[model samples]
Target: MERTSPPLRTVARAFEVIELLWELNGATLAEVTRRMDLPKSTVHDYLRTLEMVGYITRIGETYQLSYRFLTTGGRLRNRSRFFQTARPVVRRLADETGEVASIGVEEDGECVILHAMRGEKSLELGIYPGLRVPLHAHATGKVLLAHLPEAYAEETIFSDGLAAVTDHTITDVNRMKRELSAIREQGYAADWDEQILGMGTVSVPIVIEDDLVGSISVSGPTGRVEDDDYRAELLKGVREAANTIMVGYQYGH
Candidate 1:
């Protein structure tokens, strides 16, 4: 029989190698081999193939991601209706509340900030656009997680292993499950210094025609945000903003 091609494992390794290039910024043969603990020959072959397909580039014996792969994602972001509709609302919320406001989309078991507006306050922990936050930590992540199917929620919690980032972080799966259940009942989720010291956040899901489109959030110092009254007010504002986006999304259809 003729020699068969490599298995699916080969294809997966090839993609993993491509991902490694993104994290490396640019990696030499030695760097790639050492980082991935793979043979130099295998890495070199993957790099060559990626370069040929315009997915990666070789520069002075280093490999980095090429513009081709980024182009597709860039185009998608540019055309996204979610970003367009949510940006103004996020800006308005930030300006009104004088606190950081953000919009996050569920991606790869995490909440990825698509857009954000920094408040007037100095020294704020701003979540810039394109920042990836784990679903186990932040308010936006919690709200999105609360809206997911039970199976997905369990899978995410179990897969992520719920590492604790702060003393206040809920690392126990059962506790987080209960919290998410409460969030669903309350129509919002709140994080109290879970990810970072002195920071608190409130988030609400942006539902469109009963679909979990995304989440919108407000965040600031825990001192200013942790009170029950303040939390309720912030949650109300987030809900209003999310509703505005949902209305536009539904009406535009």
Candidate 2:
């Protein structure tokens, strides 16, 4: 079932004001008006509501975001149980494939790294827990995008816009759409130096309860990853690891 957004009201606008303050690291009322492109009166109303709710604080001449939002997002993340289930699975995939293995979840149309395991042999692909990467420039993003609802997929891609991070990155909207379609059919996405130089990666979506909830990935230097057999074996191991996590997710274990 599609989730319904909260009702649009003063409360919702107050939250948006807090987010903008957080993004700006605090701003004057004039700056907020310019960034939000709203009338001064409207911005002041939202700021007053947010201050009343303890979500933002006004100190002297500037408004600042409070830590309450951090607590809320942190609580939601801790309740997900995603890292606990993915840790061992990622380790196993790294051991089997002899490549860096990772598990990530989608948040706000971006990939948030939750767990990663490095192979015994050093690989140059840089990934670690808590590292966040944009969805437009990564194989992991492609897998997650391919599995999302069509409307969400289209909106994110269009909104984020395809700016080339590297020479090999897909920069055209139509090309990206076609690429995602292929990933959906093949059950995986691959990139050769698309985001970083001399690195390659494969990403596969993790499905549970018929929802595309996360992604599993294997990455290594181009020489090892470009080998056809090595790539195939890595994809196989990634799929197996994702399946393991899916089973764990299904049973609440």
Candidate 3:
């Protein structure tokens, strides 16, 4: 095996604190220390440095991320050809399905929602652009995982520890391997109350020029998705949206 060095501990710690803050929206020193299992002094040093650098803001004993992160996301979204191409496709899928449709890509061992559209009947599920989700937790996530090289996929799962959000989440490695294989064979993936208790998603990979770019999904309440005819319509719409994105991307490029 080729040896690879780990990231510098200081840099990693900084990012760990940042991620904790993102997850919590804002955190007190004690909250961060308790959640991340880091020393208070260490957390304090990182928080001070981050706040001093204008990457975070401290207000009334709570530390929150600066708006710079949103600005960064907007800049990156503008530059992303995939995001540009997939945006309208997501909108159309939402319109057709009366659910929320999204396009997402793999980043740093997680799936990040790049764009999302909500239909008139869509329930606000709290999903949004720039939201990062686990690779083994949702439909888009499974699609992302199914498309990666086996070694890379396994590495992501091993490194992330398959953190379970619900009782239905797949936590066993061997079982997850089998699930990924099934997703690959099926060409699309479904989430039935795995990530959240009531939501369901059906996703298809957005492939461009024979390469997997990302996944498109139509997600809504499980009741709507459980209807057999409605499920069929949702799957068809999602797949068509993926095809449209691929065509638009190939043509525009």
Candidate 4:
């Protein structure tokens, strides 16, 4: 059996400090020390090291993340052929549907929005690139989950235990499994005020040569999304966008 190496404590602590700073949106040396329960000198050293590497910035006494992260994230996104190919298609879908259109992929058992574009009537739901959410709480997430390997999907679902984000969110494991099965058969997923109240979403998977690339979704107010005529239109738009992205990615366009 292959044994995995344990995580390095020094590196782990450094990441913890970074996450703490992110959660606080910036923190004084004293504040970091208090929150991390680490020695003041230790926290200061971590902060200084991160600052020296340009990952953190010191303004007055507050230490915050630097734009270096943004640069790194942008470079990573640019490297993804799938994301690059999906960008224009997703933007067009947003324009056609007049809602929030996004592409999402599963990472570390969670759904991460790769890119989100707002249309003329899109709601300001704080959806953005790099936003991560539970896989059972939204249309994009459900589509990705439904397409993933059975063992991996089962592990993710059981481990996460289906925490409810809103009253409409599915909290039962069996029910969620049934939903995934239906999604597989129907080739799409829909969420009505599940992740966020008043918001509705419809998503379709982007499959290339039987491989699940990711998912594309359109979101809007429940008032419009729940309407039979409008919902059908949105579903048609999202499905077409997903197909465009899949074909573009497969052809290396």
lDDT of 2: 0.82
User: Lowest-scoring 10 consecutive residues by lDDT in candidate 2?
Assistant: 1-10
lDDT of 3 by residue, 1-253 (tens): 3336646889878888898998999999999999988788988999999999888999999999999888888999989889989887788888888899998999878899999999989999878998998889999989988888778776666655788879988888788878888988988888778888889999998766667799999999989887879888999888888888888888986
For 1-253, candidate 2 gives per-residue lDDT tens digits of 3447777666666667777887999999999999878899999988887788888889997999877776876666567777777877888888887788998788877888777889888475778766777776788888988888888877765655788889988899888889888998999998878888888888989887778778999989988789899889888888888888888877856
Best by TM-score: 4
Please give the CA lDDT of all the candidate structures. Answer: 0.84, 0.82, 0.87, 0.91
Q: Which candidate is the best by lDDT?
A: 4
What pairs collide in candidate 2? none
Residue 253 C-alpha lDDT in model 3: 66
lDDT of 4 by residue, 179-248 (tens): 9999999999998899999999999998888788889999999898999999899999998888787777
164: Cα error in model 1, Å: 2.0
Arranged by TM-score, best first: 4, 1, 3, 2
Error of 1 at 5 (Å): 16
Model 4 TM-score relative to the real fold:
0.96
TM-score of 2: 0.70
Scored against the true structure, residue 194 in model 3 reaches a CA lDDT of 89
lDDT for model 1: 0.84
